[model samples]
Target: MQHESASAMAGHARQHYQETEQEHISRSQSGFPDFEKDMPSLVNRFSFSLKDNLSSYLGSKNPFYSNVDPQKDYVWLLDNTAYQNRIGRWKAEIVAAYFVKNSGKDLSEVVGYIADKIGMAKDEKVEETIEQRIQPLLDSILPAHAVTIDLQGVDVRLGPSGRDGISTDEIAIPGHGYKDDQVITSQAVKADATTMRTHFASPKGWAVLSDIDDTIKKTLTASPIGILKTTFADEPEPIRGMPELYKHIVQKLDSPPFFYLSASPYNLYPFLRDFRETYYPSGTMILRDASWMNLAGFLSNLTQGTEAYKVDRIEKVHTWFPKRKFICIGDSTQTDPESYGEIYRRHPKWIGAIFIRKVTGVAEMDESTKNDPERFKKAFDDVPRNVWHVFEDPNELYTKVDALVQTAT
Candidate 1:
């Protein structure tokens, strides 16, 4: 029954992808003047279309080509966590992007859409300025192709940004005696870019892999209107008792490295990073790489193929730190159960514990399935029953986390 349901869902997703791609191509041809100019060649368009379709099918997004004026564009450096390689050397994965700023008209249209979606009155005044609230959404990405970034004081020059306006480089740290969890602040030598890199020594210690949306921060993913309101208009709110609980986990496990895993697109990096720094432990944020051109993609990002997306990322993390036990934290609002369960099955020893927040009070969610014990049981089939937990209150996990730590020791 579950297999059939999954197959049906996958088919629906593929159908939706085809429809959306056609819509996007139509919009580009009719509306976007720049898109046609940038993708002038039929061959180029075909190639990009092929890649884009393939990426979407694989539950990811490919970076499209864009003409960007360097004078008008800026770079965003994303924070990353560093790990020591098997060769006993430190390495960091740096991800940066080049983007042209959106115009006031663009911002206004987005704000209007968000307002209309959430049924906000035109005269309503939010606590913060509209610009401040919508800052993360204002980037028009440019393919700052082949632009090198110099990591100041580290003697590492990161290789060029790809056609997606983003560059991801894994470079070895030159120094030998850096402390575990020591933060290195790197600045781009030429561009006005700065980002932090947190180093984790190669040690067989406990680490955390936490979901964002409803796990720590309250993002009402189940409700479309709720998602728009909370994401664009309202201040981000942390789930009650989660901050302290994370702090307890950190202290109990001697400050294990944290990975904030989310299906949210990378555009929300700065916004989510600020929320994490203010409330939770500092760790690497693993966000989806897709940059969407419209508002609808935001909701799609939070809802689509999240199980496979998360499983892929967790496998990458496992490759990095196979010896480190992980405590996976997520909410029932999405596919956390299935994703975590799959990861646990693949690497039973690598996962120390799994906690799924049994989210409630969201009227839009299908509570019957989301809160079903049989669903969880099926998701976590063949795994030890004690290894995975579903709880309503964050407070309930305090003792469980402590017990896990004690058992690990």
Candidate 2:
């Protein structure tokens, strides 16, 4: 009975992975990408088969890939890293990313290890094609806007929606800025895009730059399966006391702009946005490029490249708000501490405080991360202890932030 149960569980997991893959296949067939036309030819298929078989053989022999299982998931995650817009201009530059990802659990990790060992996972990067179309859904929300379409893509130019008769909720970034008088109304709409609008906050005021996974949302990044379950299967759950803390900050700042910066893919933007609207302050979302990889690839990105990715985003934000001081929030799961520290070093005067949520539930970490000291001790060693804080609970964050930003505010 015990053996049977084990087999059943494995089989169920495998089936789920297969079903998910099939669903993606169906979606592609639904005319989104015209996958049939893009399908590889017979010769290409032969070449790919040869490469895949070679990889499988090599992976089976690799000592590090001993746990290769058939039931792993490879997902393509979308990461929207940067969205550049002027304070009162309709023109906006939306920079996004798309890539494959691994479930980072069990067989997925093992396969990722093998894929990396065999050089089959060349970042699993997909090139952007000129024919690919980019569309913004909330154009009607703008009072006056024009889109220039080309074979290459479209550039969205938005003009100011002067406050004459515009409701703040209807415009992406209201000309008047968000005010207590402006309330988000739930109206029946034919397009999901109506819910989305792109606008930048008026600069020069303090803003909060926050991390998504684990810091605000309940992403179990430490566990491979935990990651899959949280990001894929579970309804996004907010970290306890986090919403209240964010509310307090926004209230104190009287509604400063916010930016949710993350390494998570752009595919999750809508998901995270829903959660944000429900519990946190509204702001621009910054995500890294998406990718499809197994667990090994996930770790490779997190360990070898995450710090650079985060630092680059932070620097860009600093460039945009050079004169504005900002609060940085992230979790201790990955390299947030180090990444934020690097940003602080470059712009010491601009970083008001760095908050790292210490993850105590998970015990295991990647070999590279295992060497790092607990919390902000080593990551922000040179920075004043008061400037950066590490805590397990969100309640503790309010006090630490108050100590730092109180006088500045």
Candidate 3:
């Protein structure tokens, strides 16, 4: 009983801290809410009450979303494979983010539609962001030091490896070339352990670090409408042949670890993670925390700080496996060419290859390429010709990664 109270108290404290910090970031970006709570109401209490009552009426009538009362979830768990030496010395860490969503059914879909019509829905949803309420707390039910395999079973606190990352604890594994079929299973999760296997690591410690959008999935990111449809409305679609290419890379590396680094907001973590699991091999997924406004705000969130964001994640991944060589995969639709190029310049010895897809279909990208070829060219000018390749089709990646593996061996 005491433990339960302690856990509950911790949760509230964490939630308060998160809200305060995020509010500061918000103020920096767009300033605080137009009015303070103590200040006189602009619309007055009666006017706000009337609007809420009307919204409730509309929501009750329309039944906008097909499912009205789906189950609410507070815990989201991401599981992936990670790599380390046989003796529990990690070669690379598997990073998984734990996030909670304000139940999807916070208000009826019709309520959201109304909010959208009124230009206030986005703000309302942002306020529902996971960090706004859910706090990290110890699972009081478990004895101290004990944790649960379930993402929500414990209060999760991530470590410093990532801008937001959790540290993996040491798991005992004997010296290898000892076995390939080795696997570990625990009835309950330990304090610092995440779900991953160490036996699948590449023989030479080579890892594939890839981006999620455009390169592997059809984000059509250049189009905000496209981004909305793909990210939220439609099931994610994979880029053709890319899965086969990634699988082939894994096969050739004898099961090298895969790290997916993206600037996609954390809110979409489950959506993207499912796509990766279905199409690509399991690996750690790193994502950023962001709020969803309407479509325009959604697009802005993906691109804001994206270049610097990638650099920071890449540096963090590199830190995890200082001795391993990496093959980076990204698309030219954004600043990937520039970002990867800069990474190569700084850490040429650490990179084995860089692949950037020649992204097309969006009008802005088409115009950018046609209008100024130099922009793309100069992004890679500092990068070595042998280290990077830009291909529109995935087949080219197969041939290149194939060659890279064969020649290295």
Alpha carbon lDDT of each predicted model = 0.68, 0.48, 0.52
Rate residue 173 of model 1 by lDDT: 66
User: In each prediction, how many residue pairs overlap at the backbone (N, C-alpha, C within less than 3 A)?
Assistant: 0, 14, 2
Once fitted onto the true fold, the runs of candidate 3 whose alpha carbons sit more than 4 angstroms away are 1-74, 80-88, 91-111, 114-203, 291-297, 364-366, 370-372, 407-409
TM-score of each: 0.81, 0.55, 0.62
What are the per-residue Cα lDDT tens digits for candidate 2 across 1-409? 1121232234334433433232233233333233223221111101112233233323213222211112321111111112224544322233321111221123333334333433444344311110011011001111111111111123222211111101111123223344321222221122112223343444455788998877898765454444534544456789898999999887776576788988664445556677888988777787643222112223223233456678887887776667667889987766788888888888888888888877665544442342345535667867877788777778887666566555553
lDDT of 1 at 271: 84
| lDDT for residue 199 in candidate 1, whole number 0-100 | 52
Q: What is the lDDT of residue 399 in candidate 1?
A: 89
What does the lDDT read for residue 242 in candidate 1? Answer: 95
RMSD of 3: 12.9
| Predicted structure 2, TM vs. truth | 0.55
Highest lDDT scorer: 1
**Candidate 3: which pairs clash?**
137-155, 159-166
Cα RMSD, model 2:
17.6
Q: What is the C-alpha RMSD of each candidate to the true structure, in Å?
A: 8.9, 17.6, 12.9
**C-alpha positional error of residue 275 in candidate 3 after TM-score superposition, expressed in Å:** 1.0
Instruction: Summarize candidate 1's per-residue lDDT along 1-409 as a digit string, tens digits.
Output: 1121232245446534634332344233333334223221111111122333333232212243233335665667777777877877777777776655543235655566567656774835752444466655555444433234444354554434444446677777666687766776766555545455555645578899999988999875455566667877788899999999999998998888899999887877778889999999998899875544345555556665577778889998887788889999998877888889989889998898999999888766667867889989988997798999999898899989889877662
